[model samples]
Structures are given as C-alpha cells and as structure tokens.
Target: MAVRVLAAGLAGLVAAAGLAACTPAPSGPPVAVLFPGAADDDWGASAEVLRRELADDGYAVEVRFAGDDIPRQLEQLREVLAAQPAAVVIAPVDATAIAAVLTPDAAGEVSVIAYDELILDTDQVDYFATFDHRAAGRLQAQALVDGLGLADDPDAGPFAVELLAGSGDDRGAQDAFAGAMEVLQPYLDAGRLTVPSGRTDLEQAAILRGSPATAADRVAELLAADVPLAGVLSPSDAMSGAVAEVLAAAGVEVVAPGARWSAAPLPPEGEPSATPTPPGATAPPPDATTPPHTDAAPDSAADAAHDRAAPASVVLTGGGSTLDGVRAVRNGAQTATVYEDPRELARAVASMVREVVEGAAPTVTQGATTDNGVRAVPTLLREPQLVATVEEARRVLG
Candidate 1:
C-alpha cells in the first residue's frame, strides 16, 4: 500500500514514532527513506521496493514523502535526524535547500545515501545513486534525428525544431540539456535544423519544475505564431503528453518513425489502461489528455478534406517510460521515450545501505564520482534504454 503523510501532520507523525510503520518488528537497526513526493510514480515505486528490500535485509524500514514542499521536507529531515537512524536514503525536493538541514552534526553517525537526486554543496552525503542523465538526453536527441530521417537525408531543408529542457534548479536537468546540445548544435550551425521560436538557450527552454502545463503553453504559443515545427524535443513523458495534445488539437499529426496513426478514438486521459503497467515503470499522467490519432474521421466532409491537406507530421521525443508514453507510441502520438527502471535504482540504493549498515565498503564503479561542489562523492550511474515501439516499451518497462 502507498503511504503518504500530509505536510502539516509530518511533525506529529515523526514525534509519535517515525515516518512509516516497520515490517513486523524486524531484528536489525532502523533505516529511513525520504522521497520528494508520493505523486511521482518513479518515487512511489522506488519507495515500495526499498521498503521490501531493506526489511528483507533485516533492517526495520521507515519511509516518508515530503509532498514537494521544501520547508516541510526540511522539517521531516530534522525530525528524522533527531531519532538517529542507522542510515537515511533521500531523493531531495530542492537539492540545494536540503543541504542546509543535512549538516555534519545533524547527520551524525548516520550513513547518508543520495537517491536519484544529488545533494549539492555538502560533503555530508556518503554515496550517490542515479541514472546517467546525460546519456538519457543524448538518446532523446538521437531519437529525434532518427524519427525525422535526418541521418539518411542530411540535406533536409531547415527543419524547425523546438527544445524543451527540464527544470532550472535540477543539476540533472542542466546536464541533460548540455548533452543534448552537444549532438544538436552542429545541425543548427549547418542550418539543417532551425529554431523558429529562437528559444534555444537552457534558460529560455526550461520548464519550471518540469511542469506539463508550462510546456504545453509554450508549445501552444509557438503554434499560434505559425512556427513551422518539424520536431519537438520534450524533456519527459508527462510533458510530451501535454505538448502532443496541444498539437493534436491544432490538427497536427504526431507520429513515431514507421508508425501509422490509428483511427480508433483515444480513451479519456488518465483512464486505466486495459494493459497493466509493469512494476518500476512510471505511471501515466492523471490529468493529461492523450493526443488524437491522425486517421480518426473528421466530423464533416469539409473537415475531412482539411485533414487530407494537413502539413507534415511532427516528430516528438520524451523520456521516462510512463504507461501513457508507451500507448502514445503505439497510437502514433509520441515518437519515443527513454526507459530507466526505478526498481533497479532502488535495489542499488538498498545494496549500498546494507553495505554501510554491515560495516563494509559500498560497492561503486571505480573512479565514478560526482562533484557536489564541496567534494567528489562516490556515484553509481545506471544506463537508460530508448523505446520506440510498443513491443520495445513492454520489454524495457517490464
């Protein structure tokens, strides 16, 4: 069962005992897992996996969600630190703000493992475990190139592409943008790809907190201005769904490579899929409407004729293998999404915590370190896979 505590009651919950109820009075010392929020499917899945694995390893596990409130998270962290658990694994809401609460004295004798997001400006973190964000960004860019047939036809005239980067505060987001630009800058220079909106800088393209509505609004503005967009490099699956809907509403076709648009009407947004989502895969967005397929019949003969005269299809790329993303790929709404298994990430963090609790060195790849502005923290990075087809999505997500 998913456990979420209201931000207002967090202090009471911690004072009463800890954030979560332990697993049947386990024998070993207690461990605590802190996540940014319960809303994100990736964090929810990871929290459950961590709870089970840590309990199996003879540790009494307690999990808590901060509900995306930085002040509330700080309060929870302070309270958790007061109890002095054997270890604490955290995926921060605000990476820099959390550093203020995780001083050496505050985290005394407790092993701190940064989960997913790195804790910056503090040397207090013991280890960092996350996916290779730069590589994920590179894969998204490559997907756009492949979907647009740019590799085979380099002379394709001035294809207009818009870049949507992740949140500005996130270090991972910055790295991803940089990596994507490394691959895309050459095309821009050669005039193969053009930014009609001219919002190419990370500052301009960034969607605060990776908000889907913000991304959708920006794309809508671009569309209203009649910017000829051949492709859109979306940052995540949720944002991709939002952007796709805006395009679909404007009668633009969004299709993956080699995928034909389905004529079947799309199920309502956030409707439970007949296909069950596999464990560890991100959940579909609750409020985002699925984009309409290109082959759907128009309401009138005039509308049908207009559809037949529609402009070129747009190639859109996303990451985070959410269920909606898979379905969108199947129905020709999104081009591709990169898959990063959250269960694998949880297992890695659990292993590191166990190592620390058992008084052994945490196993990390040799010389894999992430500089957290203070010192080089030992880091473990997992690779992500790109899925364009439903078969590939099922295989990778499952």
Candidate 2:
C-alpha cells in the first residue's frame, strides 16, 4: 500500500513537471489558483487537478503555493488580482486575514472562487466549492457508534469516548464538532456513552490548529489518569494517528482496522429506533444501506476472541483520507477516515469558473449559501465518504 501511494505521488510530480516544462505562452483567458500550501496531500492533488482541467478548457492557468504563510498568501493574492484574470480560485491560509485583500473593488471583475476553505469577512467571493464539513462530522460520530456496536447493543455499555475537536479559528472544525456532538449527545443523555475526561464542550476539546502534539498530550494525560476509553472522536486523520500512538504506547488495544463487527440494522422507514431523538428534530436515516462491516472477521478467530476479551478495544474515527491516515487504517491503527475527494472538488470549481467566465450562473447539485460576514456567498458542498478497509482505501486513494 505504501509503495502504491509513493508511486502515485511520484507520477503526480512527474506529470506536474512535464506540464510546467512544456507550457506555452498564455493565449487563452487567464485564471489564477492560489493555495495556502502544497504540504497537504489533498490540497496538492486539488491544485494539480484544477490546473490540468482549466488548462484543458483553454484557460491560461497559473498555480501558486504560499507555504502556509498568511502574508505570503496575501502577497500572492494581491499579485494575482493585479493581473485582472478572468477568475481566481483560492484556499486561504487564514480565512479571516485574507478578507483584507479580497474586497469587491480589489477583485473588480474577476470571479473569486473560494476553494476548500471559505474566505471570511468579505462579500466579494463569488462561489465556494468544498465538502460539507458538518456532514463529515456527523459521519465520524456514526462510524464510532457503528464500530462499537452501540446501536445494536445500546444496553451493553456506557462506553467511554474522548472528543477531540480541531482549531478554534477554523469554521469547518467548529462545524464538524457541532455535527458530531449532535449525533453523540443523545447517546450520552441516554447513558449509552460517557466521557471519562469530562471534556465534552467544543471549547474544551478543541486542539489549537489541530496540533498532533496537543492531541498526543491530551491522550497521554487521559491514559495516565487511567481513563479507559472505548473510542475517540478525532477531528482529523492527523490527530487520530497521534491519539492511536498514545493509546498503543500506554498498552491499550486499539480495535483492529477493517475487522468485521456486526452493525445494528436500520430502523424501518417512518419507524423509531432505540435511540432517542432530540426535541424538535427527526432522527437521521441510517448512514448506509450497506454498512462497512463484513459478515465475518477479516482476522483469525483467535484474534477476534482476544479482541472480545480485551478490556479496552478503542475505536478511533477520523476525517481527511490522507495517505498517512489511509496507511493507519490499513495497518489496524485507526478504524476509519473520511474520504473527501479533492479531485471532485477541483472539478466543481473548474466547472464554476467556466460558467462564470461565460457569463452564466454556476450550476450546483447541492446549492447553499455561506455568509462571509458581509453577504451569503453561494456555495456548492459535496458530501464525503467513509473509508474503513484496506481495499476501500486502495480503491479511493488510488
């Protein structure tokens, strides 16, 4: 799996190099793509896809990376906007800080598309193309419930779980946390789940910048205090890996990734289930018609028996189907990670650019609006998938 991942990355690099080397002078309408950094695998993939797709559509595409420096990103945006390109697609380093330069007048006639991350505090952003973060959070919580067999065995446990939210400054992180809590809260109230650390609030659970060290420290502290956790709701794949490491080092048995565990059958249509619904809300439909679980355990029977006997088989759930995250899932370190396909997002943005450039309204399958502290920017939010098995990871990550 690692070899395959590496090979794919190498192929991408070669393709990018070839594209750069063979580039001709700009003869088509100019389009600028500015990203916070190329360090993130998802972002890098998105940038490459956008460049190729837009160029194929006869646009003069220029892609820039800011190395996660807010000032550098600001400078790049300013420089790009100065050219008065037909369109500018950006994923900001700091959503709030970038608003200073992404004003209506500054962007003039250029249609600004906020990619991946929303650019806040400005009304100039024309469209947003990204994943539905709140839905991702809800999926994470659902994965935990399914992994622990909580839905099927509601009376089996007041299982201890830890909550780890993302950076406070990031709106997507907050939305994810909120969405997860919405699904988990009813379980907590019904005594199906418990938090031993007593840190349930978003503010309390948030790790600044989703720092791995912070997450590791928190997990270590929990272990030191002998908090026997059955699961952890991690905001991202990076933190999930960190938390799993801490658990492993402390002698906790993490649930074997991709192992089959029986999932509770979905309730009949228009019928209520054992789980209680919050007031003024209807229960969410089952996440899948066919859950990720298999009919039989993937490992040996003895190993399955040992897992059942283990006092704490921690089920870890994460977001971002990053290479490291997929590797962890394949190796039985993390149970699952959400797959938000960057290529799909980039294609959406590319299509939007084409429509806007041709003076047509952008067509969105899932249309919504995000208020960027000035006006509600029209947005197209794509749903993400959950990856739990090596085969699933291989199929999606490829």
| Candidate closest to the true structure, highest TM-score | 2
Candidate 2 wrongly placed segments (more than 4 Å): 1-26, 39-42, 258-310, 365-367
Kindly list the per-residue Cα lDDT of model 2 for residues 162-207, writing each as its tens digit.
8999998788898899999889999999988898888899889999
Candidate 1 C-alpha lDDT tens digits along 21-41: 653568898998989868456
Q: Can you give the lDDT of residue 183 in candidate 2?
A: 93
Q: Lowest summed-lDDT stretch of 10 residues in model 1?
A: 273-282
TM-score of each: 0.78, 0.79
